[model samples]
Target chain A: MPTLRRDFESRDDLIAHYREQFPEAAAVSDWVSDTRGGRDAAEALLDNVDPVEYGRTRNHLSGAVTRLSPYLRHGVLGLAETRDAALAKVDDPSRAYKLVNELAWRDYYRRVLAEIGDAVWDDREPYKTGLDAEDYADDMPDDVTNAETGNDFVDGSVRELYETGYLHNQQRMKLAAYVVHWRRVRWQAGAAWFLSHLLDGDVASNNLSWQWVASTFSHQPYIFNQENLRQWMGGRFTGDSVGGGSPFRGEYDEIKARIFPRA
Target chain B: MNENARDKAVIWVHDEMLSLSWLGYVRRAAERTEIVGAVFVFDDTWVADERLSLKRLVFMAECLEQMPGVEVRRGDVVQEVSAFAEAHGTTRIVSLASTSPRLRRQGEQLGVDWVCEPPFVELPARIDLKRFSRYWGKAKSRVFRTTEEIMEQA
Candidate 1:
């Protein structure tokens, strides 16, 4: 029942105060996210949201995602109010349709979590991949955890998560795919790793989305090839050969065939 | 109706409802009653168990700073809420509703009252939740309605 100090001269002071208070966490990762929290910050980001451009480029890493997840996750911005903000921005309601639809995904996931409770950590259904859950390894590979994976995209994405405590949705999905499929690790291990790092990490969205990629909560598994990776990387990373050959380099048919050999 | 009754309540501001609007909702639900305390507890055990990074705590702290009425504490939620209420001589505890099982458990332990936030969208009572598309089928029209239109329907 200890009270936290309410006084701080600046953000540095605030970080310093928390570091002293939570030394174990500071020891784990001293990195602090630039994404500030609170209503002022949330409203500022909300004011700049361009729903039209968001629809066009949101799939790409450089897209205008509104970066409102941390706020939304913490409930600093009401979901309904945010949707209304988007609607108010455009004359025709359809222009804001994509953003609104995406927000609904959040609501949908939360409803599932509410119903299932602790089962959010459980596999919602059997793996759609021909492989059994037993086929996946229980431990996260050291290479992936250490961000020492030879794959440029994989390593870059992991490092981005550690350094920023945030990832573009593309980065998140790509890295999740690599962990669950490429390394053949169970999705739970990968989800736990993300929970430790992501600013917006929550049981509902994080675990279910991982299950979506692992094919345990969706119709099929998610996989991407070199071209798809490069397109979304937005030039921040290379899809070029790593160590003289790229693992992601191939057509979806070839990739799927390799990834799901038993299928 | 009396001032003594008005001062007998506390608000448990859990992690999910850190917004100003949530606070406003709690206040309105109190019906002009003077809430003696607004408390947010940092579940250190849960954080350590999850191995959450320091950045997450910092982000939460930042959020708390923006919340004008919340008293920040580090400990078990139930104990902190109880200690806070005892200190302020409050017997009634209230909070905005959340889907988090942990929060719900703690809320029940503290005998907290829940006020539901305004809905993001209204759906049929038995809508399919197995897939996003299925839920969207039932949620889209209601979500797409303008606020004015939604209010008018209400």
Candidate 2:
């Protein structure tokens, strides 16, 4: 094996070079400007974490989520460094506890991966919901992938994921549930799609999370009603924005009755 | 570990552990175990999958550029690593221990020296690996402890 040496005069040049090699990834060329990969940039992002705000807004679409997953996923920054940064931000260690706990989830998944190895791709346990693993379809719906799902929130999230190579954490859960439960698609299919696009996609984190939504790793399937989306995402992706109708617009009980009639 | 002994060792940096501190730690393990060179191999078998995103490749390339003198190669991981070691005149290969099953398997196959970094959490000897809460309860104290404290305990 011989060493290959090449240099980029600018970030744009690098993106262009990458595009030439992988033309199918043109949807994400614009994303390169937002994410500059290197140690210094990672440290700078870590230095600006706000634990208090993060605890409050993490569940919202426009949350104060520290977009540091790309660096953490790639090993530009370590878990200890991020945790230390969170603790340094406030007087009480407990104040940063929520942020640290989330970081710990990443570590937890890694440990699970270490133990399970390739079995992470398999369901850890049977689905808690009425349906069995064999009941789900093996392929992702083209409607979902192409952002033509007719559901405003889901479509918006899909576009965000493809165009930016990232998504809000809450949005990820909702989307995962939609794919696994609502659409009856296999969690593995959704996981692969996410891994192909997410800048922070680690196999353990992404697949295990999909399993969680699919009820294979959790107590119950994670299904969200339209009201829940409306509460968090505001009116931008509901009602009139969705042509005066939305599949996710009903009350929780109505959604439960409609989506899971057998349950 | 004599001062001159360091000159013979080669540090193998993989994509999973790109931190300078990790490399520096491995380099400083012995008085003169100065890194003769570092190598980053892009395994063709691993990257052939559809899930291997271009962004990750670009990010890895950027990371390799950060290291002062890391030689990049493309081929079988074990073969590339072995060739680099042979060319550098050192059979000893040092790398950070990784959780990836593939990387761990490669480490064993290459017979490399693996260094364990301080983990995000330190678990009890007996752990219920089924759930996150149970794991967190057992490892929370150590997880929140500073790196300095961890190093002191080590």
Candidate 3:
């Protein structure tokens, strides 16, 4: 029922819009802007996202355009009104369907939140065991923090996370697989990072999606190989590439050399 | 049974906002039924635990805390309703007819006169009739959807 639309391309732009729109209202509160670590998170994730390729990328381009989740979550915008506005703009049913699916997934996760409770946080036993112990032997907790383990992908991603507080969805999967399987750190740790940084973060979606990638809950855990990573990177894997050539480039012994030298 | 001394009303909400919606219903029903206000009940376990986020919990708490004219009781659905009914000394229960089978069964098992209130209320007579008529038309259009069906022989 209330029409409130504020548009800006940068943080300074956003600030300008806020000041212009709510001159009488108090300056935007820290609770509204900073607490979630919004600006830093967005910059981190957006770092690796090439501006030219950003609009062309498949995963989150639509999510980027609307960028209404935070507003919806905070009740600053109404869901039905937003849906009506989107449908009115786009004539393509398929695009509309895609947007609708994202929205529906929002509702689905909410329902799952109501039903599943703590079970959502539990680890996937089969995948935990199914993986070769060697696959995880070198997984260090610091892989998340150190980031500079000779893997440009991991380093760039961590930097992206530190800078933007967001990541391309595809990159999120790649990073999750890298840490969970390739590096073999726990998924919960990675999910916590996502929750801490992502401004658009919803606990149910972030946690459950992480668990899904971790192969903890699904019938089969998703252990992505180097080839899949290459495909997502648009087949771009130099030493400068995120994971450094094939995730399987070096054998189990070689990965140990690169990531876990002391072992 | 006597019509004048219904004594109490139970608002059967099938969803989250049912508390607010039922409160409105009780106000309208007061004109027709001899009753006090209403009681709101929820099945704590039936709701998804993940959805009870800190933000949502805070929001629901605010709603329940601020509600002025009605009493709110929360617990396992049947237990709360039965307990409230005994404590308040009322038999007449008012509930929204939830499309959910579980809720409908619960209502049936309660074995009391339950009024199944509609979710939406028609506009009161005092508002502009033309605006209300337009709203009524648009509401019907929004809800109606086309789907294929096969006629069956009885």
- Among the numbered candidates, top lDDT falls to 1
lDDT of 3 at A253: 54
Q: What TM-score, computed on C-alpha atoms, does each candidate reach? A: 0.96, 0.91, 0.45
> Considering DockQ, which of the candidate structures 2 and 3 is the better prediction for this target?
2
Clashing pairs in 2: A226-A248, B6-B32, B6-B33
- Writing each residue's lDDT as its tens digit, candidate 3 over B18-122 gives 234345654575455545545545345532322122222222223343344446445566766666665555665665433234555677776545443332222
What is the per-residue lDDT of model 2 for residues B4-54, given as tens digits with 9 covering 90 to 100? Answer: 443576777876676677788777663455567788887766665544566
lDDT of 1 by residue, A1-263 (tens): 28997677799999998898898888778899888878899999999999999999999888988999988888998888899999999998899989999899999999998899999988989888789999999989998878787777888888889888999988888889988887788999999999999888899889999999999999999988888888888888775545668778799888878888898
The per-prediction tally of clashing pairs is: 0, 3, 23
Give the TM-score comparing model 1 with the true structure, all chains together.
Answer: 0.96
True contacts kept of each: 0.77, 0.49, 0.00
Worst 10 residues of 1 chain A by lDDT: A238-247
Model-by-model DockQ, in order: 0.78, 0.50, 0.04
Provide the lDDT at A122 for model 2. 93
Candidate 1, residues B1-154: lDDT per residue as tens digits? 4457446788988888777778878889877567787989889887887788899889999888887778899988899888898788766788988898888888889888788877888776877899999999888879987656676777
Better of 2 and 3 by lDDT: 2
The TM-score leader among the candidates is 1
For all candidates listed, what's the TM-score of chain B alone? 0.89, 0.86, 0.55
Kindly indicate the candidate among 1 and 2 with the higher TM-score.
1
Least accurate 10 contiguous residues by lDDT in model 3 chain B: B145-154
